[model samples]
Target: MRWPAKLPAGTLNRSIMSAMDVFPTLAEAAGVEIDSPFELNGRSLWKALRDGKREPRKDWLMFASETPIRGHFNVTAFNDEWKLVQEIDQGLLGADVRTHLFQIEPDPNEHNNVAAAHPDVVEEIGEAIHRWRMLYPVSGTRHELVPPPGWRAPKDWAGYPVAVGDLQDEPAPGMPPPFALPTLDWQHGEAGRLIYDCEPYAFLGGGLCK
Candidate 1:
């Protein structure tokens, strides 16, 4: 991301951002307007970066990070000062789940479990993560320890189940006519048949299709 004409050279920044920030950041940096049906989970960091400022990003006080890890779900919420962790959590188990807290700025290595010391913080982040997780559609993906019986990985690209010919050559049933491809695309914007039409909601939040 070298742009000597704009940003300073060889500098350190402790700004916290997520993978979701990339699109808006690059779009803004490239001077593009984002017109879409849903709001973006991440805002552009270009201004802060160019001006060498330490302005916290929108919703910087808290963020919920959830992903599948180690055959289970790794859920966490963090701010500049604190991070709350719930490892191997699938959200099915109620009170059985245990939480761990850390003053991340001081304990970057996470060598201490300050959950008992900061029950209030734990509860705050716990509720945040819960609300965030619950926002996903009911039919969203679950943490599967392993594929179901008889499921086998494709040995090669040629053997992939959804090969080129397996797809429809024509647009979806109610899609616009072939002559309107470009117009249809403009209307749809970034949303397409990708991920069965939900866009990146499972991770970045915000479903496609207004």
Candidate 2:
């Protein structure tokens, strides 16, 4: 909480919050107007911070990736009570996904596998995750942890790094342009491909090639 903003101190809020909430919360606190084409994923927590009490979680479903880094993803979906985790191996093909479920409110450490006991919950959450994932544009975000045969960081992070605005719009070294994409088989040839066999139906014919 910002000191000048007068947000309360020493507040224990049980509300489940995602990093995404920071944007909306801070923007509202700063009195910044937000204009978006669609509804935002997060909400302002300014009220809860002021009250310093257990805040009701407004967001019911949240998706996560980049646990510590990209390529290897420990994707999690959860609400206030139930938490679902998928250990994804972002290797070459990246098809396998191991799911783990826990009643987060009770077992925050996630010691037990309650998935078998709660088939309905698993199906419900899993289906929601699938639908949410389907919203991805399919133009990017390929999972690849195994470094290529020969590759090294171009520059050190503490040294030189390209900003998003300074980055080139051109595709990577061997990436094909959009016009030529429809004819190519993304599965075999493309360097940037999403997890194997996981692409949506539109991606089959390179219609949604990254």
Candidate 3:
């Protein structure tokens, strides 16, 4: 489906598209080469979404580039095929990050563990968490937003922090340790924070770090 033209000013959403599917659509619409999958930095994309720095372009396609942090994604009208879309980098702290995508099905049994407070709130939280995972792969370790012994929820669930601890059977060679998922507590108004004591994993993509 095409993205809503009237979404909130800076809202971000995730989509599941294969390279074969998105490439031609972008090519036909924008006359740009989508012949190959391009490498992108997760941190740069994240910051772009976090801050509203979108640029409108012709060919119904938009592109944004960040220096030394090359990466790109796509967007399209709700009904049209996905088009190559790029977000402007905001130079946020987590710049140059890479992400993995995963699936998250709902679990009724795990309802008690969430601090949604209200049923609707719980559902919203669940969707957010699920989307987060779908967009980025978990490090296998669950991270918590609340620091140890001081469990406080973040403000507006703005940041859903997850934990990553030392785990074996890495996904890629030289992969960093996985972090745990962060908890979302709406009551305390505490935005989640991902706690990783070590350096972030290096992202691989075209013109990514060059």
Q: What's the TM-score of every candidate structure?
A: 0.59, 0.58, 0.16
As for candidate 1, its clashing pairs are none
Task: Please give, for residues 1-210, the per-residue lDDT of candidate 3 as tens digits.
Answer: 233452355464343223334444444434464344765321122222333344222122222223221122221111122221123222335423222121123432223223323445334433444454455433222242213212233333444542334322233332223332111211111222233333433233111111
Colliding pairs, model 2: none
Which candidate would rank higher by TM-score, 2 or 3?
2
Off by over 4 Å in 2: 58-61, 64-73, 88-94, 137-139, 142-147, 151-210
Summing lDDT over every window of 10 consecutive residues in candidate 3, give the lowest-scoring window. Answer: 181-190
Output the worst ten-in-a-row residue range by lDDT, candidate 2. 147-156
lDDT of 1 at 93: 44
Relative to the true structure, candidate 1 has a C-alpha RMSD (angstroms) of 16.2
Give residue 65's lDDT in candidate 3 (0 to 100): 27
Query: In candidate 2, how many Å is residue 165 off?
Result: 37
State the C-alpha lDDT per candidate.
Answer: 0.60, 0.61, 0.29
lDDT of 1 at 206: 28
Q: Which of the numbered candidates is closest to the native, going by highest lDDT? A: 2
Model 1 C-alpha lDDT per residue in residues 19-137, reported as the tens digit of each score: 88789989999999999999998778787787777656435233334432212445667766788877653433443466889997789999999999989988888887778768752
